[model samples]
Target chain A: MSAAATPPASSEESTDASSPATGRIPGNRAIWVGILAELTEFTLMFLVYFFARVNHPQMFHEGPRRLSLLAGSANTLIMVSSSYLVARAVLAMRQDRPEGALRWLLAAFVVGAGYPVVKFLEVRWNLEQGLTGGGDVFQMSYYYLTFNHLVHTGWGLLGMAWVVVRTWMGAYDAKNHNGLVAFASYWHATDLVWLMIFPLFYVMP
Target chain B: MTALRKIDLAWALLVLFTLTGVFLGEFRQGGFWVVLVIALVTALKGRLVIDVFMELGEASPVLRRLVRGFGLLVPALILVTYLWGPLLARFNWLLE
Candidate 1:
């Protein structure tokens, strides 16, 4: 499913809404709906965190105190850079510059790869300190939220890899570049969710 | 070209500043306010990611509407649930 497999006609350049190509790609509505669904899921998780805090403030504090905000901040920067690179790739593709797009996608893939390594180290350090989620509500929430985020990050890395391979092979162009757009949206949404999660779980006191 | 480059530079600097703030604040004692500011900065960064990086600013009107609707609804839904559901649970009045 490489984007370059389908070359759009020259007439496809118009951004007019009345153009036949306007709604051809999977509508943005679906993406927004997915975002909303994930937001609802996150909200429920947050409500759980809030109720837990109300019931067990000491436990929440003890667990949160062990988190490394340094690693969290580093991961944030990495993901932000990755998003920027992906956006650049999309822009390059829109300008019909496949080589530039490929380079940017590769940059994004490299940054995406760094995230899981940092997350693995964080988890290992936490486990070394006897902070497994097997006991206590706070530990459970910690594992649940962070692990859920880790899973999404893993998927995001894989998606970026796919985009890199496709872009390298001239698989995407302006008209049929939904994969790039979709991947960027998914990756940014993951970051968006984390922007909230990091504060609520790791930073808030 | 200059305008686009400036926008990109501004976004990059904003992200760097936010990251630095978050890191410095994270290690400080009694850092709740600092973290809160970091969160606000983070949300601002998110908007940049969406508007500039994701090109939502140039998105079609229908697409924009969909994004705006979802954005507003998701937060509102959570807040309503948080506010009312807790009250109902405590009083057991809504079920009755």
Candidate 2:
């Protein structure tokens, strides 16, 4: 059924946790526990990046120049776009349009999948340019941070795949879609991490 | 505005801000002010993702604050480290 055909959501009718008007958790509490852990892990990693940069100002300044600007920019675009699509998918579900939600989710998965590919090419190019994990402190931090983020993104991509299958099977709808919402929260958190990482490594050097 | 339209707006602004950061980084020389501006931009981007994309604006106060604190704290830390990095290094040396 199209969202256009569904009646507008009434406050009296939406007493559930998923109601957009209420000050409720977007997903379940468990996923938030995981999100907090993820945030903590990244915060520690960011501290490491800052510490290394402080100690090696010259190397930090030179690092971004040696890297491929296009790769970094492309990934940033990919991440934001993918995040937007997933968000749209959730909104589509909220609108009670399962087919629309599925379409948006599949689009998000395809875009999110590009992240690993771009990262692979970027790493290969870096290796060709003599930027290895053992090269210097800057390279070490870059590899450590970005690769960690890549791993998280890999998890998020897998989650997206699972949710895609669920959506196809009519497992989610407007009222009881905690699974989808939890996955969206997770994917958004991953995207948030990437936004911070992008400037730290590529833009700010 | 419709919720979807609001998210669309947030997406547009996110892309615009990202491009702005890249432009500044590419064109401007590294300096105290440039570092400060970049840090601020990073903070703004983080807030957008939290409040808009994550849809945490109306959640529990503690949960909202915790995430928002992160969005603000990291950039503040970045700026602090940028300005006082040498001093921090010395402090570390002293501890060692």
Candidate 3:
């Protein structure tokens, strides 16, 4: 994202009249608006998932077994780890530990970058197993839902890259990290979506 | 005891719950209770992220409620459909 588009951490410093987080929204309000929109979109998609499952219980039952448990399991671990590391990053920055925060953020970006790589391989594996989006109702929903999530994750990775640059420039400090917090909020929301997606598509067997 | 340590603990618990969910997904005998257990775990993991990582536990009431609702919406719906497939299916005609 462009610097012009991001919420100013400077504004945060001037506006915080009480305690640090006395009347804050946690992150930028603009980002929360986006998060709300994204969550609503996913909620509707989830309803679509259940609709298909209701119409095809057998496919729903058998579909999860066909997926690579190893692949789904790998992705799950990576997503949760990435979220954890970023949460720590926020905590580190808040404690005036920029080096620690940067370290954790770098670690998070690295782990987060793994999600797409694993998904690419998982897509290949699915293809090798003769599973395509058009395979069946369950497979169709699976492909669309997960692929949409992959796109969202791509957005998150892009945002994280920007955060990396800003953090490298020493733009975020203990008292002002609104941009960093906003980026973390976005990534964590994406993580939340994947958490739900994993269970709905991969686990509820 | 510290908040940083607490975040680590939450992360550890999230990983543990995820592995448990996957284990049930892979090796379970497959029944109603199995699905319910997975759903409950999913809900717990989602709430932890919202409360701990998102810093929404002490957030304003409106923001907290929104986050909490977003976290639970999908899994709750899934459980509803899973446990009451036939009954829900009967209302499927309404959509059409």
TM-score, chain B, predicted structure 3:
0.89
Q: Estimate, for each residue in A92-136, the C-alpha lDDT of model 2 and write its tens digit.
A: 898899999999999999999999999999999999999999989
When summed lDDT is taken over every stretch of 10 residues in candidate 1 chain A, the lowest stretch is A16-25
- Please give, for residues B1-96, the per-residue lDDT of candidate 3 as tens digits: 455766788899999999998788778557778877887888999998887788776555677788789888877887788778888888877977
Interface RMSD of each: 7.0, 6.2, 5.3
Task: Tell me how large the interface RMSD of candidate 1 is.
Answer: 7.0
**Ten-residue region with minimum lDDT total, candidate 1 chain B:** B73-82
Ranking by DockQ: 2, 3, 1
lDDT tens per residue, model 2, B44-93: 88888898888887566677888898787668877888888888877667
Candidate 1: RMSD over Cα atoms? 6.3
DockQ for all models, in order?
A: 0.27, 0.51, 0.48
Best by lDDT: 2
Candidate 3 wrongly placed segments (more than 4 Å): A1-23
lDDT of each: 0.64, 0.85, 0.84
**Residue B78, model 1, lDDT:** 30
- In model 3, what lDDT does residue A74 have? 89
Clashes of each: 4, 0, 0
Deviating ranges (above 4 Å) for candidate 1: A1-34, B1-3, B10-14, B20-24, B27-39, B58-96
**Arranged by lDDT, best first:** 2, 3, 1
User: Who is ahead in lDDT, 2 or 3?
Assistant: 2
